[model samples]
Target chain A: MTVERSAPPTISEVAAEAGVGRATAARTLGGYGYVSPELRSRVLAAAERLGYRANALARSMSTGVSHTLGVIVADIGNPFFAGVVRGISDASRARGFDTIVLSTHESLDEEIAAMHVLIDKQVDGIVVASAALGPKTSAHIAEAWSRGIPVVLVDRAVPGLELDAVVIDNREAAREAVTALIAAGHRRVGFVWGPPIAGRPDRRRDLVDAAARNLWTDGERLRGYLDALDDAGLPFDADLVMVGEKTEERAIAEVERMLGLDDRVTALFCTETDAVTGALRAIRATGFRVPADVSLIGFDDSSWAAVMEPPLTMIEQPMLALGTRAAEVLLALIDGAPRSQPDGAFRHTLDTRLVERSSVAPPSA
Target chain B: MTVERSAPPTISEVAAEAGVGRATAARTLGGYGYVSPELRSRVLAAAERLGYRANALARSMSTGVSHTLGVIVADIGNPFFAGVVRGISDASRARGFDTIVLSTHESLDEEIAAMHVLIDKQVDGIVVASAALGPKTSAHIAEAWSRGIPVVLVDRAVPGLELDAVVIDNREAAREAVTALIAAGHRRVGFVWGPPIAGRPDRRRDLVDAAARNLWTDGERLRGYLDALDDAGLPFDADLVMVGEKTEERAIAEVERMLGLDDRVTALFCTETDAVTGALRAIRATGFRVPADVSLIGFDDSSWAAVMEPPLTMIEQPMLALGTRAAEVLLALIDGAPRSQPDGAFRHTLDTRLVERSSVAPPSA
Candidate 1:
């Protein structure tokens, strides 16, 4: 299994062979100022002979900027992240910056690895859309900031991080979606929730006790749904709630099990597009017509939502805007602009609109 | 809108400010071989005052290697490419290499842009899955070779380019699929062909033109179908032929239009999974029973193909193997290994297999 190692030679070796002081060899090999042609030739030849390659990390330590940006996402397979990546790529290209994209897959270790990679590469800035931030990940980003590398949080915000961020108002968007469903006459609505990992420590506690107290996005959304229900004089039914894993198959199975209950949900509110798709498939399998046997509403208006049979009623989040704004902020930081927020907590809240489609209707009698 | 530019300081200014000869300043700032500590300190102080950053591209030209890899794909949105990219990332990460991924969007200009970016970045190597290559693109890769940077062609093999490549036998796979259809008593068969584009030139012309000449994979598959038809005394009819753009919408539309023809197609063979999905949608739309009214077969046994309703019968290409092999070849080239082939054209073709499922059956009366 062993392949020939193609590792580049070390700087010390190149210096020794170049027959010059280490400092002189370093500067000449690195293409820094003040190297004569003869010395430059000697150093380059020696370095080439020794296969010495310049280390970008060391170079970044000397210079304030690395001309590289780090982009971290929860998952690459999700078309949402893919679209955001496209936007980042376009923006970064326009700014003549290169990006190092990493998929965290919702793992803290992976997120940490991504941060380390970016730090090692000495990226000028970092844009992250994490599931949640661990203390270590937060510390790593803070360290990079101390070294003058700007970090911009995207989608997921880490509380107390004091970094610029671009995000949609998830709680407001969710509440609006739930309010719409309630307005459409859904009395008994079930919810499919996302993983309860909060990005900030202050928010983490709220998320942990979300079932008891109002969390940021999820709790606020739930409160909105409840408020709408209360406004309609409908009692909130706990039994109607179903929590499922994010995968389509698992979500569908959870929905099927929930539906088999004695008093099944009359309508459903999917917290994410994946949940929506899964619920639809399960309902279809049971021969239930959308908005007939059960009305449904979903968050995140994904591309496939419009193409699905009966289409889909969804709350659309501005994914591209979020990505573009994050890039702009990072570029601004790279340009040595004053931080937008004195507290280092810059946030942008985008409006979400509900797209009414055949997937939602008054609950059937 | 005009944005403020934040360009880094140049090396020449750093040398002048350091009060040293240009050669001395370069040697001191570059951090490689030899310089007095006093001279190094003065050079560093000057560089810090002026904010000088070395030009990586120019440095890469003088040196032999750049610690970067370029990756080009026809379409990043395709789940297949996503899977391949995942493999590439995993492999590249294990070796501590950074990759710059580019999407061609099936356009030649974009593909050329990808090449130019990699060249400008002075990347150590490149891996590409091109839509088509003109002389210019070929020349760029050859130029990289002359500059001692390794290039590995992935999926697409250019015949004229003396480079290493990883690919699958598309024709043989197609033939196998058609042969399976023949085995299942399908005679009046039709094909949904891939778009006419040469992603690589070194590939056998017959294979590349299989859909047109009906010679390599496309042709061989057609031959297998023809053999089955001739053996069953079923004359090949051109009326059943349908060509579709790469999109599922177009494929479905083409299939629907072909079904409206007088003769009608009894069985279908699609060249790609997207086309197969489209054909299935069309068949369902027309209320036709799969494998009963019109049997079907597809290429590229995608993850969803097997999970679809009735499951798909398809030819499976070794996707992960293709990616891994391409990486291996590029890594080898980066290690300065001599070309395996004397003429410098190295190509490896993996086998493809037919996976039978519920999609194919004899045509109904």
Candidate 2:
């Protein structure tokens, strides 16, 4: 069957017909950034006459604005990314920008591929909840930056990337959680993390010093954990920490392994949404009640946490607010705002509050 | 600061360097459809020298092949959409197409705006879990088709659009749920739905004929609910059905109203994920233990449902399968495969099995 399709009128044609610069014509037609009322109407009138369209792609190529923000996140399976993306959606839409959501699934290669697509597609800017990046993997970000597309980091920031970022005070939050467990008379607090899984390249046994460079943001969290241990004069036990490899199933298996140990953990500190779910599932699988059997403190609050059997105690990072702030900063960059004013304001370390719920309690005698 | 950047090489440049047709170059670059070994190697070699990129966008405009599939969903907040999207992502990636995800948030205007973005972005095709389209609103779908972009519907098919769709037999699923409740000796069962909320179009006080055209697959589910009541020789109570408007707050309020009524409902059949959460929350708020105080059945089983206090008795739709089938059909359409064989296969209605859990029991005295 021969389906009838018309060749879409390009922006060059529209600009030529409007007798205006391609950028101005696109600004009016795409309904983004700024354009004068008089020129906007002229472009509209010409566009109507010529049956010109608001083709964001073609206009992006010509006028260098797509009005679409690229969002490359680390994990979509985790509900945490959904919340962050929702915030991006709200802010982007309110700013007349659409969002192109992609997930890295915790892989640097996938992240690079997605960035290529976004850069080639000509997005206005990007908000990256990036995965742990290895050294020498800076080409894609540099490529995007070279193309004048600003990158705003959210949730997890790459180590050496000098990009504006919105992140929770991970070390402090982790310390508070661990300290809370310690104050409750718990000496053996287990820690479950996303990456640096067993046999991974980044895993350095015996609690690597906070000064050391590595993949994954767990370094800060791990540092906080060590700080709490030192404050209470409790010896650090490396066996209590499990690397989840960014999957619920693997996390669950690791948690189960910890539970089966000769000296099992008394309290659990999960450092991500998937880790929390996996830990909870594993606890349930072991026929153990939360708080009663093993007190737990989870990072990144999700709706499931509130509705869990014994509502979970978690670190509630201001996710939506972080997204909003990141977008605002990104928008400013896109609008040609100076990188640093005289005051030099840059990194936004949003505070994470511990939501005290029924998941934690004093250890049983 | 001025950023020094050069325009990325286009596919035409790659094709020319490869000394092959655009189709052959695209086939090798996109990693889709089929390509011969020799031509693929030649294209790769040319891409390496010219730094020839896939660049879905430029390739889309020049060669009419944007290796990107647009996904416009209704509610990304709901886990249902997340599952469907995961399936879409999996299938699309495996088939060498990147997905661009968008949401309508249950608003027609937002839905229209999203479609405009997707269409203007020049996606290879679209899979829309469309919002309820009011009359005189078929223009955008028509516009996309006229532009040679095929759309496949998932979750629910828009009425009057002859687009290929993958949906569950919602009516049958609802009837089965209601029938199960009846068999459990519950006559005062309630139902909570998403759309057709107060003062909106398609708000028929009485159950409308099955032939009626409207949005959302709820109509079928509603019909099945009514059929179950009729089969059991019970009088239909309009009061038992509440319109949620697709938000947990509204659904919770409506559920609270049902609980506050002089003739309170003993059981609820929540028709969506948000409705289930709202109903569960309301039940908890009222200090009512599920299955003991009020037996409940929910649609679209979520992780929360599985971990609920008493778990939950709910309908588990093949959401991932629905997304997979939709993508498959869309790919076929994109490949210009024949619309039909001798059997005239088109609509794919996946099964919804009832997961029997502890949330349903005999009505209390």
Candidate 3:
């Protein structure tokens, strides 16, 4: 049998049922201009009886406020993003706003498409964990800003775009993690995961040149690794660093290569979750033990990290707080709050915590 | 300085620029009906020059097809739901649809609000992992159905709703897990998670009564536990069961109590992610070694499960497949696919796999 449905009741019908002018009914139902309490009650009662649900699209078009927040994240499946989205959604809902989430899956084309869709849908604001590396790649985001749709960046920032961003001090966090490794007598430390630059960086200058072409976060992290090496008065060795596409398989291969080197890395500084997993898998396959043959430190403390064989020391980014603060900032902007910065960009950097577990130790003699 | 934004360009302006009639421009720009190739190119180029974006809301209102999907999950932060949402989003995007995700945080009031918001937004269809357990609690879903909006359930099913549902055979999966524990020579096994029923269930009949008030999935799982007990010619002992709010803290307290029992359980079956974490914490706190003191089985395999000291045996649900199939079915329903079931409710059950790792062993004599 076919499903039969009637057309939704309109404002005119509700007004007729309530014995009030259409304007009064529209004002009451649309929640716009003033209506007397008695007339408002009649209109609402009429709407209830007639089952009149306001057309959110039409209402948004008329008022120019959809009361909706759109989020464009790289991957909703990642635990980091999952936590952030939860924070954003919770805050948005508490503020009487609805949220529309779109995952880009780390594709620039998809990110562009998502931005256009959110704009066309007239979302009041957008919070993005951009996969974009430069201004040209983030043209859609800039376009959104020009269109008066507020955009807030999370996790990463783009150069040359003046907008609000919520992020952690990636450079400082990375330096501290790597510095701890160095202080533990790990002269030969391997860095895994970074921007996928073309070819390998054979020297320190090569890395410096590649930094300008990668994600701002990755560049900061690479610089932090360099800072630690420089502070220890150790010469940079290309063989001890793995910087490229961060797939687990690629990480495993690069780590194994480092392990097989004549001057093998005695410790590892993994910059991401997948990097840590890959390094552990490689160590296991190569007949090495964590914190024994080689000590390790990873970014992103996760549930699994606590339950690992010897537990894992990690740098925990405040993912939930990042999302919540971004929403708060964006909502304030939408509410006509003045920018605190002269250039119209507000950068909020949160602190990361280092949780020391069983994964770190002095390098084996 | 203040931001100045111009009003968006209109279709009429686009038509004028393209030197075509309003109808021709509308046909070309709206992607409806037909337009000549020459006129289509002109309208397209003119629209691009004007930087015009078709109002997706208006287009949806006129066409009655939003080309959007709305997803309401219990919690997007949960890895299971996160994976499911990614699968749904990927599948939806491949089919040229955008998805709007909302998290209810397991609150029925929020679920109802989310349903109303999605309906008001005029999404083409909805896929929900409903937090509502009964007909009364799910009136919004039924209302959406009555309003000619199609909805597909994921993860959980409502008892009286006649709608498509995608789920695993939770009962069989639970029974398989429990039966494995029994076969391993553990006579006293504790079931660590289920629906929140008031007061204590002192006998097996009370459990049967409580099943009617809980979630359908929980009821099935509880029945599966009972089936395993019956099959093994074992008496149902209320002391060996913990059924309530399924919170991590609650699970920890309950498991600790079980561990303190005079006739303590030799094995435990934890039904969810939080339950597993809580059980592990309780065992560690009580100084009870895994396998040696209490064998354990858990549901939902995760990254940490593989890296745990003794690892974890888990029942792995096809979470991603469940979401993909839900979207496929909902899209089909939206596209006018006929229901194959006589009752107009199509149910698809995916298989669950039992991954045996190092967590289970014969209980100590």
What's the lDDT of the predicted structure labeled candidate 3?
Answer: 0.83
Window of ten residues with lowest summed lDDT in model 1 chain A:
A196-205
Cα error of candidate 3 at position B268, Å:
2.1
Higher-TM-score candidate of 2 and 3: 3
> Evaluated with lDDT, which candidate comes out highest?
3
Q: What is the per-residue lDDT of model 2 for residues A110-209, given as tens digits with 9 covering 90 to 100?
A: 8888888787677889988876453267667766775567888887766656777787878899999999999998988888873454542333343453
* Per-residue lDDT over B1-365 for candidate 3, one digit per residue giving the tens place of the 0 to 100 score: 11133745666667888899876876676566668899999999988888776676666665567788999998888889988898888788879988888888888888888887787777889999997776778888877765557899999977667778899888899999999999999899998885577577787777755764656777788888889999999888888888667788888888999999999999999888888888888888898888789999998887667656687899998888988998999899899886436564567989999999988899887
- How close is every model to the real structure, measured as TM-score? 0.68, 0.81, 0.85
What C-alpha lDDT do the candidate models reach, one value each?
Answer: 0.66, 0.76, 0.83
Q: Which candidate's TM-score is highest?
A: 3
Task: Show model 3 residue runs off by greater than 4 Å.
Answer: A1-51, A208-214, A340-345, B1-53, B205-214, B340-345
Best by DockQ: 3
Instruction: Sort by lDDT, best first.
Output: 3, 2, 1
Instruction: Write out the backbone clash pairs for model 2.
Output: none
TM-score of chain B of each: 0.75, 0.79, 0.85
Stretches > 4 Å off in candidate 2: A1-56, A132-135, A194-196, A199-215, A340-345, B1-56, B194-196, B199-214, B340-345
Q: Write the per-residue lDDT of candidate 3 for residues A167-221, one digit (tens) a residue.
A: 9989899999999999988999998875577578687777755764656777888
